[model samples]
Target: MTLKAGSILTGTIVNITNFGAFVEVDGKTGLVHISEVADSFVKDIHDHLKEKDKVKVKVLSVDDNGKISLSIKQAIDHKKSVKPIEIDWEKKNTQNAVNFEDKLSRFLKDSEEKFQDLKRHQDSRTRGYKKNTSH
Candidate 1:
């Protein structure tokens, strides 16, 4: 079968290397780069695929030298068939309120502790002043 550009093809993993996988489709063979193994980050290609595994790949480019560049990302359907994503504004507002309240409570507690320390210092100073004045 002629592997045309932009066409998705299914092939068996014949060989695997650190850089890419060699897939064979019918009599034709192509190289699927490690970057084209998945839509997300691929730390290791072995995590998603292995030799003798069947995988779907999309042909991205065909060089004049007959080199075929393939991508697994292109094989994914990114179009959302669902309705528009509506943010839960009310829930978000309530969550924000809860977060702000927690922060405010923490701040108030810190301020109260500082105020109490300051008041204690002032009272001590007042007592000292009274003793000095009396003496």
Candidate 2:
């Protein structure tokens, strides 16, 4: 069978080196780079993968020489479906109402203070204008 990217296939570890492990998959062979073996740090390939051991591998790339590169990490990291969290709509609405009320009250109080300051400035200007025009 033709192997494609993201394809998961069973393979036997044929060779283990300091760099990586060579795996035979579906009559074809590929190299699992040392970095693509596991999630955690691996000092040695022999510490994680063993010779003649069966493992599930994901096809990573194919070279010009038809040399295929595989990854055991990708296969292990396939995402499983998970249900989304449910929220309490009633409680959320109540909390939102309280927050909205607090914010609106603060805004109104600030606006009233600004208006009072503006009226005071306007009254002072009006008095100054009257005094100049009267003289």
TM-score, predicted candidate 2 vs. hidden true structure: 0.58
- CA-only RMSD, every prediction: 6.7, 5.1
Residues 1-135, candidate 1, lDDT per residue (tens digit)?
Answer: 677888988878888889988887756678889888877788888888889998778888778888877776677666853367888765557787899999999999999999999999999888855444654
Candidate 2, superposed: residue stretches over 4 Å from native: 77-135
* True-structure lDDT of candidate 2: 0.89
User: Count of backbone clashes for each model?
Assistant: 0, 0
Candidate 2 lDDT tens digits, 45-116: 788988999999999988788999999988874456335689876655778789999999999999999999
TM-score of 1: 0.57
- Tell me the deviation in Å of residue 41 in model 1: 2.2
